[model samples]
Target: MSPTPQAVYLNGEWCTSDSACVSVFDRGYLFGDGVYEVIPAFAGRLFGLDEHMARLSRSLEALGIVPPLKHDDWLAIFERLLASTDAPDAAIYLQVTRGAPAKRDHAWPDASVRPGVMATVSPIGAIDGGARVITLPDERWGRCDIKSINLLPNTMARQQAVEQGCDEAVLVRDGLVMEGAATNLFAVVGGRLLTAPNGPRILPGITRGLLLDLVRRKRLMELDESFISIGALREADEVFLTSSTKDIWPVVEIDGEPVGAGEHAGRAGPITRLLDRHFQALKTRRSDP
Candidate 1:
């Protein structure tokens, strides 16, 4: 496919992707000293900007990387990018790294280095019925809480999944389910919602939060937000996944093996359809002219 020209913002200036470059000596590059967040824009509106920014702030705090601008200042830049982007739907990529310093050292620079911030927008696409996933042993750091720039493990996991003909890889940590490489996993057990709770190992997901609330509001089922084992997922009544990009998708199969109720149990289950409606309602409400 041909590459598309997307606008990029870097260190307080707007430019094309090629023009938006950072120094190779930057700590974010040399030492992986940075944090990033991806905000989904659906129908020309940014989904959960506040939540994403909040997580970004938390990541920066965890890494002790001071933000170059206040949260409001960051919002102003996002708004500009959102308005200027031509796509009807897109994702906003935000990254902040401890700026380039004169030398490379394990310790922080004597003076606080400016945080390098960049933003970019790209087109969005359909979610479909969700993609198949392969399970892989978790090799990521236990502190998956912070969304830092250290993504080599995640990259490898996803690539492994793709090689196995899957869309994503569900990371299993010692026989227990952690999450997907880029999304959160959910399974219905006896009509109850179950997902890994937010902790040092799991990154809290914005769309997962919204969907769980929607399910509760409808009195359909309750979410446990507790850890579940691979056995539990294999025996689940229904299985699904959520993310800013994919929204809600029922996992009809795993590793070519049936998941949940077995052989497409949750494809269009009653609860699944209801949540799908609620998801549509959310988008329609947000997209109203």
Candidate 2:
């Protein structure tokens, strides 16, 4: 195996990953008072960069944290960081915290403190296969839309899935499926694609938006942004998850049971394959001049 990339950008300065550090009193460290966005780069091009930035801005606004850099400034920083890596396919992680306070207090600190900014790049390999998923109760806070750094609940759920030999966890709240621990969920029921409507319960994922657009344009199937009950999902013809790193991964098995109709059960269904194909084509087209 090759060594990991070490390039990182911290507060407008370039440094190695080992040299980067943040204040212990930083609000993000103390109270998870921060927001982040992950963008995938293909052939040196950052995919859905504008959308991700817009979402990041919204996350900061929701948390009442001022943006530390302008949009163009962020673009330049990401460009510089990406140029430092030789990997054609990479994932860029950008984060902003409310900054370190004079003292560790529960209350908001003075606005004079500058927000902490950090970014890093890592090589990403192609996704090779389907994923086995498990369902768990959604235990996150109400502001799931904020994309804040408070991901303890998410981490726990993902850990549970991993312990069960699964790739992801579909979080259900009150019998209704919200999303995956770190991804957006989609189910095909009766030939219609259904997903949880974006609200306070779920993060509006950029890849989810892009897939919705592609589905509409291709007219592959009926699209519905609505609630998906646990029962409905179990009875669905297909299930899939979407994220920036994992484009569109089909869920072949959920909680040890096969997904999809009997004849084509326990495998990536037809619609799932179709969407994956279209998604790859999308990447190819976007990578072209």
Candidate 3:
């Protein structure tokens, strides 16, 4: 073990990650009934933490789970965990789940059952160059708004992508593209940028939201929240995926065909590159203490 003061906050206590224990009867384990948020940290500082907390609170409210702690309490916990991590690039993962009940049951009405929370700071994986993608039917539940711990469909799709030598999977509902297996989808057609409107179809990714704000603030390009069909996505001039950790990914190809045309084919295009640069600049603002 390195000499860094590393530990994880579990339930109401802070302990070493190895010692952070959870009761077997926890609803998060038994029923996948929990919500989670990942707030990206650049260097040692948090980026868009308020936005993340707002999303987390919305998720908790949607699931009928009470807010385990106030805003100040959460800030204290997150900052403490980050202070223990020396990673240049890291993220704060916060999860809140319906507490372990006294007995195993599908539904528990006891208000006394407290929620279980786990918070930690971990290194963010780096992605080199562009990403290859495979599209699949969006076979997830209706309430994608809530960042619930139940991610069976997403995990399966991601695994499928891995088996096919793809970096990520874009999910399609009906005939329209909903989102990626874990990230939000953005397609550049002609010269205009388009992304799925926030709703049950996709999770309001913190990175995605920030990028949208940047685009609007900078007037970088024409953009819309209109739905994108699979055909449109396949024919788009450029495509990208955004998440809390990975930042942005320029999709060079889909299925087996190359994205874009001619010279820029199978490569990161102008708009995608522009957004990535600006987004990185935004991250730097939060870097300095």
Best by TM-score: 2
- Model 2 error, position 176 (Å): 0.3
Query: Listing every candidate in turn, what is its Cα RMSD in Å to the true structure after a full C-alpha superposition?
Result: 2.0, 1.5, 1.9
Write candidate 1's Cα lDDT for 1-289 as tens digits: 7566567888888888766678887888998888999898887877777788889889989988876788788777777888877778888888988888878888887455687888887777886665688888999987799998888888999999899878888989989998999989887788788999889887788888788777778776677989999988878777777888778777767787766554555364556656778987886776676
Off by over 4 Å in 2: 1-5
Tell me the spans in candidate 1 whose CA falls farther than 4 Å from its real position. 262-268, 286-289
| TM-score of candidate 3 to 2 decimals | 0.96
Q: What CA RMSD would candidate 1 show? A: 2.0
Tens digit of per-residue lDDT, candidate 2, span 130-240: 889999999999989998988999999999999999999999999999999999999999889999998999999999999999999999889999998999999999999
Per-residue lDDT of 3 in model 3: 42
Worst 10 residues of 1 by lDDT: 260-269
**Which 10 successive residues of model 3 have the least lDDT summed?**
1-10
Give the candidates in order of TM-score, highest first.
2, 3, 1
Better of 2 and 3 by TM-score: 2
User: For residue 86, what is the lDDT in candidate 3?
Assistant: 71
